[model samples]
Target: MQEITTIGLDIAKSVFQVHGIDAFGAVIVRRQLRRSQVLPFFRKLSGCVIGIEACATAHHWARELEKVGHEVRLMPPRYVKPYVKRNKNDAADAEAICEAVQRPTMRFVPIKSPEQQSVLMLHRTRQLFIRQRTALINAIRAHLAEFGIVAGIGRHGVEKLLDLITRGEDERIPPAAHACLMALAAQLAMVKRQILEADRRLLAWRRTSKTSKRLEAIPGVGPLIATALVASIPDPNVFRSGRDLSAWIGLVPKQSSTGGKERLGSITKAGNRYLRSLLVVGALSVIRRAKQLGYTRHPWLVRLMERRSVKIAAIALANKIARIAWAMMAHNESYRTPLPASA
Candidate 1:
């Protein structure tokens, strides 16, 4: 081996591909490694730069590679795509990853710690359960509507339907249909319990994390949003500014500039979808509260709401909130309430 200086690894469930080059850009190694052989193979090589595409199991592999004295850089798969010469294959993808890591301008994803990954996993699982709950609720509603038994929308309405199913007193419901609705009702109850448990775990995590606790002080930020934000962003300083963080969360407008003419459309919605949606939902809550009070602490939001529709204002508020969060995290400071317009 001619002193392999850089390596690109394409990882999968069972097999992995490796491509390596010397300092002089000459091929040093091109091979495949089984799942069992990956760590042992890297252990034999001297410390060198290794590139891997950010994907499933990428973080685990990166953590493993780093433990064996190798420098690992994780590149977004999209950024590596341009470097691929021809047909897509594990080998080509590995080569592209190898090439992309050496680029001075290429952006790399920050390696998340196991703790962060765990928190994100909790969030994902909770989201899954919530979706299941919604599906169950909708199914029950549709089934009941078939029997001319309909309830209003919301938790109370869902509970009413559940009550009907539990009592088995709705004469309109067919016996067979009643049995099916009972099954769904049981699932809905289980899912609700699971959601509450998830919320409890998240709350416990938020209590232990000083960052999450501090983040909760910000308007519209609850324990769930605070914990998710902290876990999703491993290092706030990776972003150059609050705007960058907001943009990364896909809260900023999409641009289609040409010939020095600036044209912007809807938000790019390119980055972490979960975080973006959370921020937007939080913003909407703030807007709703402000409307109820007929005044807001932040005059800028009040002015913006006066000029734009509620939805647009919510987006702008979400963008601002993201920026505020970035600043707080990067600087290790609490959120400062903006002065009232009168002041």
Candidate 2:
């Protein structure tokens, strides 16, 4: 009807809402489609601009829509919120998405390919198993503490506790209590094994990814961080500059400025928590090495560490690393550390 020029779609597990407007921005269609009807519905319409929130299933649908000759744009859910007129509903959200996609300055998310999503799946699964392993270890520790069978910190310590429990050396641990701990210990071992398998798979993936291999050349970057960045950010050129990329990664400071006064606080910590944490962890490794070498190799980091706390310096370094990574990806170059000029 009225040759719909643009459409906004609100996607859910079983149903989807659609809002459409003509070239003149007049409302033309409002409808809902069941999951099974989605492709058939879109197949009936001519190619048009479509907007969707960048949520769980958005990328898959975007790819499908694109293949059908429709232009799809995905915006972050928060960016679409401001366009909502009143109470939130599926229809309202669709309308907001429709409006948001037309804004010239509205940011959009890159649609990742199935291959990119697969690599990310590996990382996510690995993270889940690691978390489960940690929880099991903590549970074991807590249970042992009740019987005064405490061990020192870290995973090795947990293994020691498990050894004692398995040997039945302590009368303090009743047979019944020990059995429960043994079950937990078994789970911990299984989770650890799963995590290791994930790691092996990631490493195999990294070996085949030229971009991941290039990213690994940077200081403090290893297979894990390299593969993660390559998977999560399909296109680094979407950002205008390295600083923009760092900001997108939420490595930049939060600003609260008014009346032409500049006020900056801690980092916003707004985007991609997993990537941000990986960058920070990489930065920490660099910092640790720099400290051991008496900061001889990294002059800038030496100056930064002298003026700021280790935590702040680590964040700053992470921001710098993210920027460097963006440049590498944008320019298709491997990382190369700069050398100080001759006196």
Candidate 2 — what's its lDDT?
A: 0.92
Candidate 1 lDDT score at position 265: 96
lDDT of 1 at 228: 95
Q: Go through the candidates in order and give each one's C-alpha lDDT.
A: 0.92, 0.92
Model 2 alpha-carbon drift over 4 Å, by segment: 341-343
Q: State the lDDT of candidate 2 residue by residue for 1-343, as single tens digits.
A: 5899899999999999999999999999999999999998898999999999999899999999999889999998989999999989999999999999999999999999998999999999999998898888889899999988889997679879989977987999999998998899888889888999999999999989999999988988899999999988888988999998888889999999999999999999888999999999999999999878777678889888888999999999999888888899999998888896566
* Displacement of the residue 191 alpha carbon in candidate 1, Å: 0.6
How many clashes show up in model 1? Answer: 0
The per-prediction CA RMSD against the true structure, in angstroms, equals 1.2, 1.1
Q: What is the Cα-based lDDT of residue 328 in candidate 1?
A: 93
Would you give me the overall lDDT of model 1?
0.92
